[model samples]
Target: MADFVDREAIRHCLARLARGEDRRDAGLIRAAWWPDATFDYGVYSGDFAAYLDWVVPGAEAISNTQHVLGQSYIELAGDSAKAETHVISYHRVDMGAGDRDTCIGGRYLDTMARRDGEWRIADRVMLYDWYQDWGAAIDWAEGVMGYPFTAGHFPGRARGDFSATFFAAGQ
Candidate 1:
């Protein structure tokens, strides 16, 4: 039962971190990590604060992002745990020409610590498995298969995104 609880808490932390990136929510992202937590993503290696400074702006610059988490393999030991989570992330960006869709498949190797009864990441390392660059993003204006998206509510990369309201309303 304790293992199950710890695993669920760690998984939830991962989910929150992913959503934080997708929504460009710095505070949410910060909550997932310890102040001294470290990260290495090949391109950058730093503590949590530096990681936030680098990541938040990058997320803001991108038109959109969606992180799809597949599965997490966790090993628990007392108050600490190790987790490797599979992920596929999509990004829409302007490549100095037009909006392009890109995706990368990766895994997040994490060292998690349960402190003050809350589980948070103590360190993280991201490993890339594959990458694909799709030249152009589909025109959402044309909609999917020519059927328009429901008019008023569109997804956005900010705290005021539709999901926020949905969650705020206790749904």
Candidate 2:
């Protein structure tokens, strides 16, 4: 059926993104989107290039990110399709000592374009449903990283502007 074709194409594109992100492959991730894909991740908002610029640098800082996509809703009309994918992401950050958990669950509403027999995300909107509770217990990163250090420490200078720095965050 036409519905199945649309669903497959959308799913494939989303899967490409998920896998690319998990592997920290920015090039592959970029292919999943249009040259002008808009992204809104609650706090940060930008196009695909901005997203990549911000995220690719964090690849070394970030340890792991896994995207689990649930069932999707797809609508097909000739060369275009509209889809909504429910996704849950689990992220582990390395605070120097070890890795800790950071997770997010959300839905992605996407408008896809069929160009040259390939599907690409034309317009996308991210709807966050929930995030993991990070409490006062050492915070999220501190619980994982374990190092105590501060910045801006001058032997002869008055309390410099920079201080109270920490590396490896584990309380």
Q: Best by TM-score, which number?
A: 1
Candidate 2 worst ten-residue window by lDDT: 155-164
| TM-scores of all candidate predictions against the true structure | 0.92, 0.70
* 119 Cα displacement, candidate 2 (Å): 0.7
lDDT of 2 by residue, 1-171 (tens): 766776787898999888677765688788898888787767787888887886775556465567899988988888888889999987766656665667788999988988898888888788989988332223432323565334334311123212123222333
Best by lDDT: 1
lDDT of each: 0.88, 0.73
Candidate 2 residue-wise lDDT at 64: 54
Estimate candidate 1's alpha-carbon lDDT, on a 0 to 1 scale. 0.88
For model 2, state the Cα shift of residue 53 in Å: 1.3
lDDT tens readout by residue for model 1, 1-171: 888989999999999999998877899898899999999998889999998998786743377899999999999998999999999999998887778899999999999999999999999999999999988877766656768767545535522378888888985
Off by over 4 Å in 1: 59-61, 155-160
Cα-lDDT of candidate 2: 0.73
